[model samples]
Target: MAWDPAVYSAFAQPRLRPALDLMARIEPADAARVVDLGCGTGNVTRLLKERWAAADVVGVDSSPEMLATARGDGGGVRYLQADAAAWAENGGAVDILFSNAALHWLGDHRTLFPRLLGRVRPGGVLAVQMPHNHYAASHAVMAEAAAAGPWSEVLSPLAARFPVGEPSFYYDLLAGGSSHLDIWETEYLHVLEGDNPVVAWTRGTALRPLMDAVDGAWATGFLAEYARRIQAAYPPRPDGRTLFPFRRLFMVARKG
Candidate 1:
């Protein structure tokens, strides 16, 4: 499914916060070559260049559409269109390898972490952040909706798999090879204002598979079902704001 840059940036500040948080913890060093994996829209990618002005920074993404926007506002930062799963193969070694809110789209954390770390030079960083909200109420409803109705067969593959593993799973995968491994989880209860803000928020990220599975009309029905479930799960406050609690897992590992 194609990504809508505008929709994804609806709550830009909140989404960008995690990237900034991930960057803040990285060890300061002169990175001659830096790379931002799955860098959408280049918002956070811009920081890499700012932090290490002498470094040749590049933002890599799988989506051509996102790369288009990334290029438009990249502010001289190089943008590359490449599959994130083949990051080690397509993109060569770098002093710092960073990914914000993107690695979760690719599976197989068992080998993925090591492969990613291998792409960085010795003493370089491999920093990443991924949403760990798969088991949450909002996403649970997505799986439920995917299993029901005419669209079930088409969306089955999307429903059966998840991109992220457990927090401990990441630690186990990287601790053996990493000199410095930092793993943490954060939950942000975002207070949003609007009609079905939860629905709106999800449509940007988690709702892609269902949308790609069915026709416009069928997608509408599927969204209605999901919205109905989410509304019940997250009631609006007295001021009519929806409280969307999102959990994200982070890892900042430095190669030895």
Candidate 2:
């Protein structure tokens, strides 16, 4: 799916908060090599570079649109065009394998998590953060809208299955390989401005696939229906700010 760097960047500060919170919990003594997996737009990747100035930092992403924007502000970090899983399989080992707001896009955590952990050398850390709000109204309503429109046939097939499992699922997967493991969840209540801001937010991420698969009157109608339902689901407060509670999962695992 194509990504709109502008749309994603609209909520840049809110998006960056989870990554910042996850990074703070990591304890890497000296990160000699760092890979920012699914490092969209390279914004957070640059922060990783700043955090480990002496390390060789590489930003890996699959989207050309996102990578193009990332490369525009290179900031001495190398950007690679590749899938996160493929990169994890072949990109060699690193001291810090850090991913922010990525990984949830990929499935098969049973295999993916271990492969990622194996890529870390002894004492190295695999630090990751992924949106865990699949069941939240912001996302749950996507399925509702997909099934409610003339575009149902096309969009229903595209409806997202919740990708990120519970915290226990990951803990069990990484326990054997990790010398130290930390897993937690955080729900951020974002006070968003503007009309249907929650819809605008998902448009950048979760809503894109359905939006991409159709066009003409059906596409327009589908979006309108989704917007209608979303407005009702997340009504504006008395002061007019919309409260969007987004939950995210964070994991930091160190190899023995």
Candidate 3:
């Protein structure tokens, strides 16, 4: 799915809040080098640079468009294009391998986690945060719409890939490599305004796959069906704001 920095950054503060929460949990230590994997538009990467001013922070991303915006200004931080799944090859041993809302776009965590952990030094940290809202209504309704609508025949396979696994899945997966593991989930109730805020939210992320696979007209029809379902699933408050509850998973592991 193609990412739109403008669309993704629409609710900038709400998105940035999760990255800040994850950053707060990171133990303070001497980090000579840090990397922001899948660093979209380098917003959080800039934050990482601030938190570790002494460290050589590199914001790594695959999208040229995001990197273009990222390179515009990030203090002295270096922004470059690289495959997120193979990010470790570009840089040597890193003290901190940080990724926010990016790793899920790659393949499975079963092998991905272990490979990523190998890039960290013996005492280094691997920090990640990914959307666990695939189980939420915003996603479910889109899958439902895709399966039942006129586009079902063509869009069914697009729903096959689910990038996120539950918290338990990670705890067990990383038990051997991590000495001090911090794993948790947060459900953020974002108060949003305007019509079908949920639809607007997912358009930047979840709904992109289907939209990418179809033409403008079919995509419009599919979005209409999706928006209708989501609107019903999430109603507006008296003040005309819709409360969108989004779930995300975070984990910090120190290499043993």
Q: How accurate is candidate 1 locally (lDDT)?
A: 0.87
Pairs in clash, predicted candidate 1: none
Count of backbone clashes, every candidate in sequence: 0, 0, 0
The C-alpha TM-scores of every prediction are: 0.96, 0.98, 0.96
Clashing pairs in 2: none
Once fitted onto the true fold, the runs of candidate 3 whose alpha carbons sit more than 4 angstroms away are none
| Residue-wise C-alpha lDDT for candidate 2, range 1-256, written one tens digit per residue | 8899999999999999998998899885798899999999999999999999999999999999999999999788999999998987898989999999889889798999999999998999999999999899987789999999789989987776788999999999998999999999999999999999999999999999899999999889999999999999999999999999999999999998
TM-score for candidate 2, please give it: 0.98
Least accurate 10 contiguous residues by lDDT in model 2: 156-165
Error of 3 at 234 (Å): 0.6
Q: RMSDs, each prediction?
A: 1.3, 0.9, 1.3
Worst 10 residues of 3 by lDDT: 84-93
List candidate 2 segments past 4 Å from native.
Answer: none
For candidate 3, give the lDDT.
0.87
**Tens-digit lDDT string for candidate 3 (120-221):** 998999999999888788878888888977789888777656789989989987769998999999999999999988888888877777889998778888
